[model samples]
Target: MKDLLIGVDIGGTTIKHGIITKEGTLIDKWEIDTDITNHGENVPYDIWNSIKTRLTDLQIGYDRLIGIGVGAPGFIDPISGVVAIAVNIGWHDFNLKEILENLSNLPVYIDNDANIAALGENWKGSGQLVSNMLAVTLGTGVGGGIIANGQILTGTNGTGAEIGHMTVIPENGYHCNCGRTGCLETIASATGFVRVAKQWIEEGKADSLKVRLQEQGNLSTKDIFEIARSGDESTNQLIEYILDHLGLALANLAVTLNPAKIVIGGGVSKAGEQLSKPLQKSFDKYALPRAKEACEIVIADLGNDAGIFGGAFLALQKS
Candidate 1:
């Protein structure tokens, strides 16, 4: 019988799972809404039940299944598969591995979502040629994963490559949800872009964004990017700020890690060259010439499926 690996990605709102062969071909995929508010403490159990129910629904025998891999949002212990902390999910010191193993009777592996996404990209996405690369996800908050020499590089304490939290300003800047000030996420994330745009409107700037906001009642990140594409001055300025911050952050990573390519994938990255063009230029400005020359900042090839595909691949690799 062929070994089958199960991969699960636990996000703030959803849990995505995929079953795959050892060679990385996806065989099945499914997702469930994550009840972070009520069941935050039992993330592992929820994750296990999700997979068990999905596999059972598919009529796959437990004996034919191999190990499981999970990608979660938080500080994760790669060695022990414990979720140390996740601000959004309200989980701390979670022994995810023990709980999942008990629930499913399968060997399980878990890591931060960004790291597994990077592994997935390296295995099947845009970073195929590059041995060293970084994966940055621009969702509600910016998340990053660093892979070096074909291995996921989680530093001591399993908190390495938190690119979003890197400081872009020193004092008197917008505060981050992580209780910090001047984090890059404050300037570059989806929330940060809207925050800056709202301030512009408050400053009496004229733009289509105000009209859109008034009509739509709320501004999503996609709305802002779309408005910016129309050459709205206020929104354009905000995009410039986001690009600068993102570029500076990428430059710092380039100098430090010397990765051959930086792969960007997220809801924000879908903006395409509307984002990458300015971002590439900004990276050139902030990064050292040699580092800039050595690295290529490119958009992430994978879409929403990256998490599921990467999660599945991580499980297969571990097994």
Candidate 2:
């Protein structure tokens, strides 16, 4: 029988799983809404059942399955398969690997979602060229993973590349979900853009976005981008705010890590060069000369499937 691998990406609101061949093609996959309200203790069983049902539906025998690789949102101990903490998922000191191994009777591997995303990019997507690169994901919040010499640099406590929580501006900025002020995510993330825009709209600033949001119901970060494209004054200002912070953050990372490249992924990156242009300009100005010369920042080649491919890479390595 041909060998198969299982890759899971767990998020705050959904759990995405996929089956893949050794070549990194996603053969089949599905997503389930995560009910974190039940607390983190219940996540493993839910994941186990989900996988079991999928396997049964595919009619794949257990012997052909090699191993399972999981990417979850939290500080994970990859060696022990324990999640030290996940504020969004409500998990603390949870034994994820043990539960999955016991349920499926298969070997399991786990790591933070950002690390897995970087692995995904490295395996079949953007980072294939360079050995040292940083993958920064601009999701609901910012998540990052650092890779050096084709291996994840998860630092002590498996939480090294917590770039989102890094302080960009020292004394003045909004509070982040991680209980810090002036975090990169507080200004650069999807939620942050909307927060800044909504406040401006509520203040009755004159712009097309206010009219658009009033008609389109709830305003998303994407909506802000759309309005900016159409020449909305307030929307343009919001994009400027985001680009300034995002560029400054990248410059800071560039100076410190000096990675060969910076691969940007996640939903907000969909803005493409509209976002990248200003960000690149800012990096050119702010980053050190050698650091800027050493690195090339690019959009992630893989779209939503980076996580799946990354997870499959993890599984295949184990097999």
Q: Which candidate number maximizes lDDT?
A: 2
Q: After superposition, how far is residue 15 of candidate 2 from its true place, in Å?
A: 1.0
Candidate 1: where are CA atoms >4 Å away? Answer: 37-42
Q: Provide the TM-score for each candidate, comma-separated.
A: 0.93, 0.91
- Candidate 2 Cα deviation (angstroms), residue 68: 0.8
lDDT of 1 at 173: 78
| Ten residues in sequence with the least summed lDDT for candidate 2 | 204-213
To one decimal, what is the Cα RMSD in angstroms of model 1 from the true structure? 1.9
Clashes of 2: 1
Candidate 1 local lDDT, 191-291, one digit each (tens): 88888778777887746778888998888779988888888877777788779988988998899999999998888898999889989989999999998
- Per residue, candidate 2 scores C-alpha lDDT tens digits across 36-118 of 87676777888889888988998888887888889988899988999999888998898899999999898988989999989
- For all candidates in order, the CA lDDT equals 0.83, 0.85
Candidate 2: lDDT of 23?
Answer: 76
